[model samples]
Target: MRKLPNLFKFDEISDGDNDFKQVMVSILKKEFPIEKQSFFDAFESEKYKECAEVVHKLKHKIHLLGLEEGYILSANFENQLVNNSFELYEDFVIILETIENFLKNI
Candidate 1:
């Protein structure tokens, strides 16, 4: 697994409301895997536009997780997918996996 960056934007945004934080985390834990699988399926099928759409959805989660740089990369990758490019695919996958591992441990 890649190194998890020290991210707490979600914590800051939740305003110390543990209940609200838990709800948001729960939503992410449930939704992320489904979006990830959709991304993989679209990628495997060579549906670049569809892949872009999934990335679009996932990028919001990236931002919510306090990954400012990752969010920018995701936005760029989303655009690349729309243009049928795979140049940043590996880097983007690393971000996804990092988030996956973080969510699992949380």
Candidate 2:
């Protein structure tokens, strides 16, 4: 598993506004799990198009979390999903799990 970066981008975006940071984190806390489930449901059902859509949403989260490499991985995975290819599935799952654990301890 790759080491996840600190939320520096999020901090910078929040611009020292703690309320803004909290709100952003709150949104991520609420959305990531829901989106994660949606991705699983779509992937398990072989609904590649749906998976792609969820991944598209997830990519933004990846970017927001300062995960440039993860964002790239998800972008490739999203594109591959269009052709029903899940070659990067496990790698993407690692990213998801990394984020999940990070969120939990934060």
State each model's CA lDDT, in order.
Answer: 0.89, 0.93
RMSD of 2: 1.1
| lDDT tens readout by residue for model 2, 2-105 | 65756788799999999999998999999999999999999999999999999999999999898999999999999999998889999999999999999998
**What local lDDT score does residue 27 receive in model 2, on the 0 to 100 scale?**
93
**Candidate 2 clashes between residue pairs 3 or more apart in a chain or in different chains:** none
Off by over 4 Å in 1: 1-7
The superposed Cα distance between candidate 2 and the true structure at residue 25, in angstroms, equals: 0.3
Candidate whose lDDT is highest: 2
After TM-score superposition, what is the CA distance of residue 73 in candidate 1 from its true location, in Å? Answer: 0.8
Clashing pairs in 1: none
* lDDT at 67, model 2: 93
lDDT of 1 at 67: 84
TM-score of 2: 0.96
